[model samples]
Target chain A: MSADAESRWPAVARDYVQAIADTKLLLGQRYGEWMLKGPNLEDDISGASNGQDEIGQVRQLFRLLEKQGVDRDWLETDREPAEYANAQPLDEEAEAWPTFMVQVALSDRAAWLLLDAIRHEDFTGMVQKMGEDEYFHLEHHDARLETLAVDQPEAVEAALERYFPGILAFIGPATYGAGEDPLVEADFTDRAVAEIRGAFREHYVDLFAGTDVTVPALTDDVPDPDEWDEKRRRSGDGHIDQRVADQLQGVTNREYVIE
Target chain B: MSANTAGTGTAGFSIGPEEDADEFEQELWATVDEVPDPHIPVSLVDMAMIYDIEVDAGEVTVTMTYPCMGCPAYDMIQDDVRAVLRTVRGVTDVTIEVTWDPVWSKDMLTDRAREELRDAGIGL
Candidate 1:
């Protein structure tokens, strides 16, 4: 066999990709929930577009994972809540617009950092294509959060205090599995977890300052690794809510395939 | 970039000098250019998704990109590429490779594609 074919691509590689895919899939569903309930007509429209974009990225990763024998269909529609690898905040709907923007600012940045770290890997090509979209998503939320910072400072602060720590878990455990660091060793991502977390802090701190929102201090933002499931790279349990899942699927009507 | 017609199937393609490869490449590009982006109704060529193309005798290879990372039309686009290219003569095999470098953007769209988007009410 050629060197590339003979190479024993590690199962960890596939697991990491699967984790990324699951995260995007769930994140999309969570965003989709806000399509109607967002603060205004424009927020609703933005939510719908961002939700669809995230799901589209999920479809791409699932297709890639399928080459490694993963079933794309099952990954999309059939999985227990705990089985999903998405960060904890996405497990539940955003309690409010500020909460939603908090997830967007931190959770979306986590995804972007992972993509940035993994850009050099052979299999990350599809994920990299998502950078442009992710950038837009971040900017979209940042703007919304900035507006909230001025109009509803109390709401924005409350959400930061509540969700920032859980959002930190979105970075995954600093180390995972028996000294097997797939993030580095498998070329899945170039940076160490600490480095990523640091960058995350720096990015958000600057973002909050620019938006006139108070940036949460990193000291108080630590995630408890003991609660983290390294395999799934998630900090807490529970999948998407079932009722929300039905709404995301829009199962009642499937008359025509979307163009 | 070189093509040798001496063989058939996967082994049919042969590599040679650079100068001799241009005509074959152009022909293959033209053939696959007919494939359209299912969602947009614009040719993949116009969308700049066909990043690279290689032809060796009866075997043809194409590298393509999606409009976005998780574009739902990915499979359909690839199938269209393979289906269209296979219709070209002296091409018994088809290979489609996906790449993400220089990710797709509005700027990548050809003038014709931009015009179509404009007609469709998408802001430039």
Candidate 2:
């Protein structure tokens, strides 16, 4: 992290953007793991395509953060685990296909919601393009969710219970209803964390309602956001996966790099 | 050189507001148009990927964009752009910059490119 970046952006802007980028980076890493491992050919190809889209979006966000004086290299690597602001759920690998789909569906929607709120002068175009890319991603995930509704309903429900609750906390539950978040006060984001979380919750609730799976009605504050860490933007436990840390280190093609 | 000879008619691809292309500019545009995208069958110019080409004295700068932010072959495309631009005469130095200010859309494709895509079994 550059000292200049710290001074260049308001704390809210820096924290908000970095967390989004970091989470997407980890999500992209998770997607890459499924490139050749998805159950079918279409899933395999879609996984690769979505993975590339995530990385591509990450690249764009990093470029923007770079212009704001954040060191692109540092953002990619060199930060400690706790220093990472990614959603905690991204810290783990999805063990099965349904779990992966559920995780992706939730993560992608959360990302889109945050990105939608953060759109400003220059970001307006990028956010719109991302919406286009995300449309297919969410569609694919929703299709998978419907299929899993019949095939692996239990797994899907478990994933929803496990992951969905943590997202708001990941996105900073501390800012929820605690008056206006600094980002909103600074006009960096159009919506408060509360509005974004509310939309996310409403979307999943309606989506789950349509599914045949008889899961409990989506609950709010499941993990209890009272312990949400303002700085880490999470519930104050866990860290990103080690493999993700290696990726953040940008350690591609070990044989190619000179010692 | 087949691509350049096949279509000397620069119907749609042109720089700035000037629809007219001088002989040298046409050659440079043709040089770029001939370098095929790794994924697509049509030339970059046919695909309308070349946004603008500015030539001043002996130096040239080519500004362009990929269809998506996450194009896996962007490096290859950029390198190919540099190599082809260097081959053109009156180009002493070459600079390439990719921008996302106006994100790429299918609307950016030319009529010829669209036809080629359809022929190649690609949808608009």
Candidate 3:
């Protein structure tokens, strides 16, 4: 790689790490909502453990970002929500537990595919380390899904209809520029959206195979890019979405303002 | 005078193997195993958290320990055990004695419990 390309590499890595970390932190916070309220004791315990795993992954990724001289507060502090580049699909709201479970199953499965691809990428050690954590998370979520599907089939079906579209949105746009301004420059060797979607679809099909739950078809086309941008902008107060903000209200019971 | 002094009464208690008492003791213990561990959500029997169960007449006592001394869920687990035991057919009253004498070790976990922990990525 040329000097310019080499210079670009760290930036690439930083952007990729930031985006992934943001996604993990956001989803982890969302999952944590189920800690005490899951439909059953087993599901509650599993959800808590899964949330812990995601937090662990976030911590590791944040540490790497810190080494790159990113301010710790930028990663940890409640910031303007618009800066959170988490894919919109993962951002959809679910009004019930079943819908929430479906949302989690789909998003977590997609995340596994994305992480697996990045893990094998020719990159610095940080991505690889983060990859290991994602593997554990993937397994954890999948196990919970299996338990739910076998033990409570009706709930799984209900969730699939309510949240599957959100899962599709989570794979993100077919082309970064096709939707919102590319949050970060696409750097991975496997940059094609179709390829990524196909991989995600394969995993989804296999997960639901032989089960009563029917895998919902992916949305035929990406949401209009302009509409997506408008949705993104209207998402919430500066750093996190309204839904998350509402969920996390009084989280620490202290007002936080960046100096 | 010596005869008069020997006339002072002596008090003694007699003890024997009470079969019903033994049966009750075993029954009480069997009930304790049905209680689930709050943190792991597994039966106390499977987790081996129930170290001993003793019964004396109507009063049942259980000796138990948690996965660790500072386990945050210790109180909840104790409450769960008490609740479960209170529902047993014969248990009139229940008491749990939380102890640290034989500290809980991973070795105490059943094969299935170990597998669950491993599946969760928690290494022993």
| Candidate maximizing TM-score | 2
Q: In model 3, how well does chain A match by TM-score?
A: 0.69
DockQ, per-model, please?
A: 0.22, 0.19, 0.01
lDDT of 2 by residue, A172-259 (tens): 5634543666777776677778767766777666666766565444345643667766656677678976666876676675567654
Name the regions of candidate 3 deviating beyond 4 angstroms: A1-16, A66-70, A89-93, A119-136, A144-158, A175-191, A225-243, A246-259, B1-124
Clashing residue pairs for model 3: A79-A239, A80-A238, A80-A239, A81-A238, A81-A239, A81-A240
Query: What is the Cα-based lDDT of residue A146 in candidate 1?
Result: 72
TM-score of decoy 2:
0.78
Alpha-carbon interface RMSD for all candidates, in angstroms: 11.9, 14.0, 33.1
lDDT of each: 0.67, 0.73, 0.57
User: Candidate 1, after superposition: displacement of residue A45 in Å?
Assistant: 3.4
Candidate 2, CAPRI quality class derived from DockQ:
incorrect
TM-score for candidate 1 (chain B): 0.76
Lowest-scoring 10 consecutive residues by lDDT in candidate 3 chain A?
A229-238
Best to worst by TM-score, what's the order? Answer: 2, 1, 3
lDDT tens readout by residue for model 2, B1-124: 1110112234554533246767777788888988997897999887767888877887888878677878888778988989988887778998875555455667767788889999999987
Q: Which stretches of candidate 1 lie over 4 Å from their true place?
A: A1-9, A123-128, A174-182, A210-216, A219-222, A244-259, B1-28, B37-42, B53-61, B70-73, B86-95, B102-124
Residue-wise C-alpha lDDT for candidate 1, range B64-114, written one tens digit per residue? 777666576777888888888788778899988776544555666678888
Better of 1 and 3 by TM-score: 1
**What lDDT score is found at residue A157 in candidate 1?**
82
